[model samples]
Target chain A: MVKRLSVLDANRCTGCQSCMFACSRRFGVGGLAYSAIHVRSVGGIEHGFVVIVCRACPDPPCAKVCPVDALKVRVGGGVILDAAKCIGCGFCAKSCPYGAIFWNERENKPNICVYCGYCAGYCPHEVIALEELG
Target chain B: MDEYLKNILYIDLSRKRFWVEDRGSLFEEYLGGVGVASKILLEECPKNADPLGPENVIVFAVGPLNGLFPLASKTVACFKSPLTKSYGESHAGGRSAIAIRQAGYGAIVIKGASETPVYVAVHGKNIIFRNASALWGLRNSITVGRVLREIEGGAGVRTIMRIGVAGENLVSYASVNTETYRHFGRLGLGAVFGSKKLKAVIVSGKTMISVSNVKRYRELYDKIYTTSIKSSVMKKYHDLGTASNIIPLNTIHALPTKNLRESSFEYAENISGERLAEKYLGRRVACAHCPIACIHLAALREPYVTEPYFYKTTMISYDHELLYALGSMIGVKDTEGVLKLIDEVEKWGVDAMMTGTVLAWMTEAYERGIVGENEILGLKLEWGSVESYTKAIEYIVKGVNEFYKTASKGLDALTSRYGGEEFSLSYGGNGMPGYHTGPGAHLTYLTGARHSHLDSAGYSLDQETLKGKQLSEKEIAEKLYHEESWRQILSSLVVCFFSRGIYTPETVCETLDILGYSFNEVELKRLGEKILSNKNDFKEREGFNMLNQRFPKRIFETPTPFGLLEEKTLYESVKEFYKILKERARNS
Candidate 1:
């Protein structure tokens, strides 16, 4: 069984992206310099917001495009990144349909969500939730 | 640090040469954004400088946290305002902060005026003066924004700050629109732009930033973000937007209706946020990195009068202020009517609050028989008559006649000439923001440096005192002083006051720590006081006087949610405020 996190209700999202910022902060960074996820206004903002995060697909394209084998499937059915092996080629970042894989140009690596569920705990709007599927 | 800040960009249309100068020490002491910008204006701008002349400098500045942090997304624009003739500061969120930061510089200083129509474009670090000959006369603000977006690179990353026909025509209360919906909405910054023959300024940058404590910064960033997004405190703003204030205000009988003739509207339900959301809400949007996307857009699906298949549906942004000004203040019952008026005002780039107040003045003028149809350019002006008022607004923007010119100057000129100061509804020459909340709001508008609602948030004090007791004069003055003092710090951090609870004095100190500026709670208070003094200095240099300042008689006429405000009491309250400020200034 692998757990996936999703923003089921966007109206509930304050657009605070505390989750994405938190993930980058959890990596011990000061700003959004290297956050794994991005929250952007969808189609000119009168339309509300869309949270772009990994869907934890069984056919995860991010893992498939990792030429250096830096990304692998974790025990919980989520993707994990071995940062030491990443060449920062941005191939996986380009392959991510959801654009969840963030590139940190300064550190030369790809930042990915590991389903630690750290961000879900901080979402004040209950906009993000982690669920397990068998 | 020294290499990052180069020459301050000086564009003088009167002189026609754009030059750069060095003024870096001011930044180190005052910090960038409001503090440094204020100090610079006071030092450079001469006494009694004609606000609409080539002398007044418009400064656009970004703070240290900008580009480095996701939430550091506010840009502080400082200039001597044509509206207040005092130090004017307006902070806007959008791509403004990011654009300035990415341009690899902290501040831009613009002076002089252009003889012909022009605009400025800054890409990376290079600056170019573009001939805005064709774009100069556009009435629609969004049209100007769209044209700039298409012609320029960095569509999403850049900020297109343009003035509409209102600014081009020197409307005293004109605002500069950026990112389509966001504005430097107060104190006639747009009029200054218009006076300079400058139509617009576009900024875009794509530079990387270095952080000191990457790990700790990330940790704190995550903590703040999660806490903010998940908090129920933001629910009201996110869902219904500021329109949520409509129901509560109406419930309290504080909704200013029909130019303060009534506190609440009978057809308030039709114009309430609850109604707008249910009937016309197209979507909710957020400003650049902010999770509390409080921007609400209404879908105006109207029939095309010419063809059945050619229906026009436009999405227009709405908020509490617009709802109050265009809705209750003007006696508008139809949400669609309110939306149409709001859209038109925004397109023309006039300050919505001032425009509403101006319309309210015209409505009263018609009622009082001060002006007639010939003066009105044949538009039948009436309260709640959106059809006629819409035409009047267009005429005002186009500067159709002498009356339109004065109306465009703001209510002060109209009242001064026409004898309607009693109900003119202006404070320090700026129109009243929703809520005749009480003496705090009135006194703040009367004396606060900017004459802006955000200056001291006096409305908050009124709400607090509403719990069955009127505040003593001394007590009210103290509260206003403390609040305005603290807001100086908030504006320095450029934090949104709406999120004051989460970013308490303690949190503000901690956030400053991340940027290596450590100050205790007490020190933060002192910094705020110093900044307040600096702003007052700018006002004093411009010869701003509290004496002989016009306090609208309309305020006394209209009974508020709290009570009918007495003239003697209000004047006494204002005197008390002035006396305390004078004493404090002398001591400091």
Candidate 2:
């Protein structure tokens, strides 16, 4: 069993981008450029926010779409990106159904969630959490 | 130099040319936001420039902490004000700051007037000038935003800033609405946009920002986050939003009602924060980097008149200012009526505070037979009359006649022609804020830069006085000067005023140190003071004289929570404020 970050209840999300900041801060960086998780309004903020994060799929489409075999399926769920092999084509970013894969334009690499669960800790509203999956 | 604060994007609308300049030196000296924008304005904007002409320049700047820190979500917009006719600045909290920072620019300066309508799109390093002839005359800002959103797809990280019919008509008090809910709501930014034939601006970017100290950065981030969530400092703002001030202000007789004829509204309870939360509160949203979700949206559901079983749901954001301006000030008793007027104001892209103040004056003027039915287009203007106010809003946007056209300019222009100068309720050519707290509030309105209540928050001083703290006029003036000077640092950082308690000078210095900018607490204070002085210098250059400001006679007629404000006491306080300003200018 392994724990993964999950969107428990998106309606509780405030679109604060605290989780997004947390994800980037983990890399000793600031701004949303490298964050794996994305939160956007449904239309306007009134309808509430949609928290988009990797669901740790068994057969991740993002991993399969990588031209250079840069992404690999993790043991628990989700995919791990091999930065060395990445070509920066952004195919993996487009292939992710949830739009969870992010592009690091400066480094020319894919920013996929490593299931670190750091972002869940910053969500004040309990909109996201780290949960175990078997 | 910090990677985020590297470049400035300059757009010449008249020549349809755009260029990016290295402004690392400017950011280094001024930090960012108003600090940098003000310097840009002084350098670029001509002296005594017509606010609605090619000479005027619009500068939008975001601070270094914008995309990096929590609650640093404001984008400062600086331009020559059509309303105040002086140094003008407005801040909007939305995705605007983040978008601008990530787009690889510390600031953006728009100059010259376009021959035809256009909308500028800045996506990363690419700047696209699109023909906006079709979108120019759109009735509402929301529609313009939707159209731009459809064409330009940067869903999460993009900010759409557009104007409505009010702006297109060159209304002096028109606002530039951002993200539909937030706005550069004061000092006529939208009129500047209209004058340039610029309809909207879409800013989107994705760029990583690096920090010098990783370990120290994480520690500081955790400390700020813990303080933000655990502390009760932000509880009130998060709970009921700024609308929570309604009950307290009304209770203390600080809430101005019916154009300052009365200090408190009798039906304040019906359109209060408690009532809105209980009955109409739909959702709470936040700006990009802020954890406190202070933006409250009310769910207004209405049925179609012609169709059966068809209903439309509109979400309107409300705050204490809106509640004061459109709700109690106009004598609107019900939350529904307030929401309806707010919705109309948002659609028209007009400043709600100015609109309400003008309408309150008009309602009183009509009652006194100064303005007849001819000016109102046969609509009878009366207090709490939602129908009449709705029609008036339409007329103001349309500019149907001389009265509506003059009113569109602002209270200063309207009252000067229409004979309502006694109760115009304008301070420094800008509509007074919601606070009629006491002398502190009134003095701040008169002398504060931009004539905004948030400049010094004299309402807090009034509250302290109500709690049995008696102070002289000079002491009150000193307190306001101190607060206003310190706020320059916060605005330079582009942080929200709500987080003033969290980000002290020490903490701010620590954060800046981590970001590779070294500054002690003393240096930070000096920087704040210098910024304030520079802004005042700009104002002075543009013909703003503290001694020449006219105190509205109506405010003196009404008694506040403290008592009747005396003319002598106010004059002495203004003189003290002038002394402080002179001392600071000399020191800087």
Candidate 3:
């Protein structure tokens, strides 16, 4: 079984959003045009950072709310985006509690994580990791 | 593209008017940020403009890669330094780069001095100038940041850049504090700000950037990003940050311990990164878009002596410069004690490096009886004594007495008055950096533009050369000259000198290509040479005479980790380098 992508420990995060950039870069876009994850300060940066990404709920709201069926749950990964099927409804983005789903207006589609674990590889601080859970 | 939005914002506070100028030619020639700022300063800023006068414009610029790339988000401040009176430029990573880029402008040039205290808040397209009489004379930097944050609209997006009391008082080495922790430190741009009567500048912009080739840009960015994160060069910075250098510097006996009187400290380990992480490391933060969060915040959680239920944790950013300055420079052993002093200095908005150097000088003066107990304003000056130093730092900030006044001016002023030029620890009128490595470091500081360690990082080169035996005077001079010349590109790109390996000449050329500019290796070298010459021209026009250059004899007397530096050879080598620079300038 493959694992989902999430930041395991917040303390380890340097608040360097290489993870966000990696996700955006994997989508073949410049800037944070189509990244699904967001890293922000908890309150004051002195307090540290909070990594907000999809938990890949059992009944994924992002997958459920996609009217065009663009977002579908993969066997191991939480939600995968079929760019061709996305109708730019932005419903999946609104439904996600964590606001993990990102919509690029230029492309007019919702960007969801495929749980490829590529971003984890780039995190030198080990803030992000892939772990299999029942 | 709208031309007005892309143009540089020029605000003259003395005249109380603003205008937008088309920098298309300059921007086309050298992209935005450090590149364009330097060119504009050279072109517009008169060679003889008073460093603290309204004629000297303070330029805050952002690059093409600023909001477009992950880690390239850094703002470069260009101004005639009140500290060095040379070509002064300082780069800081925070919301500054992103704010300027998003505000739909490349650079903001602030000229003239206001009649009264004022703060400019740039929110998107609207810029409002507010009277800051109430905010002026604030003791704590955090209070200034907090007040500005509340008053300014964009809580997360906006950056409140406020100068502390040190800047208000026109301390020669005052620094402008941004987002509490990050600073465009060095060269005293803060004093320039103070001279303008401009207390603070808050900026926020949410504008998106456009890429020339989105697909190709992404591919190239990932290639850089993947390798950048995984690069061995980044491992130390990413993991332990620059604070990790303390241990290594201690091992080499070149840590600038006790104002260079001693090369190494017995209490070095107490303030090292390992110990800090164990005792005080709270959390790490990044700049606007950088993924390599190399910033370390020390969590100072202490129980209130009077009220046990009421406790507060103060988070302070720890770096090598700060550690060396506040720790080893004054012989500080207690980590918390050092942090407390550092916090006080930051609250006052002075250059941490200058403050350390000044306090070190004062400590030495006390020991030598150059300054007596009466001159000390009743505060005891002692090494490894935080209480005395803390009071001294306050006195420096307030400019309370003759001692504070002299110290606040800088080491140069203090040394001249107190007859301690031998151990002043200043080069080119600026306070010294933490490099007692070798002659290369000293020469680099002596000759580099702005007299900063970042100009060439000659210490790194010196360390590399130490593997070989017997480096000639000429060899060292030439090496320093060449590296300092090339650093023009690094500052122009506004690239962090730490990532020199990542942004190689090839990568710089390639990155510029994506921005619709093309330059070969030769062209790049020529550009660097031209910028170096331009800087020299500015310095020469400002009455800088290389022949009259003074080297502190104390350095020669003190033995370094390398060896006891020979004064005659060092002085002669510097003269040769100075001659070379002049020849190049004349020919160019």
Q: Which candidate should be chosen as best, given DockQ against the real structure?
A: 2
lDDT of 2: 0.90
Residues A20-51 of candidate 2: C-alpha lDDT, one tens digit per residue: 88999898888877888998888766678999
RMSD of each: 4.0, 1.1, 3.9
Considering TM-score, which of the candidate structures 2 and 3 is the better prediction for this target? Answer: 2
Error of 3 at A43 (Å): 3.0
TM-score of 2: 0.99
Every prediction: chain A TM-score: 0.88, 0.95, 0.88
Task: After the best TM-score superposition of candidate 1, give how far the Cα of residue B383 lies from its true spot, in angstroms.
Answer: 0.9
Angstrom error at residue B512, model 3: 2.0
TM-score of 1: 0.87
Error of 3 at B11 (Å): 2.2
**What is the C-alpha local distance difference test score of candidate 1?**
0.77
Give the per-residue Cα lDDT of candidate 3 at B458: 73
Whose TM-score is greatest here? 2
Candidate 3, B1-588: lDDT as tens digits: 223225788888987777777777776666666667877787768877898888898899776666656567678888888877778888888778767776767889888899899999887678778899898998897789878776677544567788988888899899999888899789898889898899999887545455557677776776777777778777777677888988888888778878889878899998898898888887777776676777888888778999868988899888899888999989999899888887887788888888888888889988998889877987877788899888888888788889788888898888778787778888888888887887877877787777888777778877887777757887777777777766677666656667778878898888778766778877876677677777777777788876677777767766676788888888888888887777766655
Per-residue lDDT value at A49 in model 2: 91
Off by over 4 Å in 1: A1-43, A47-134, B1-25, B65-72, B206-209
Error of 1 at B27 (Å): 3.8
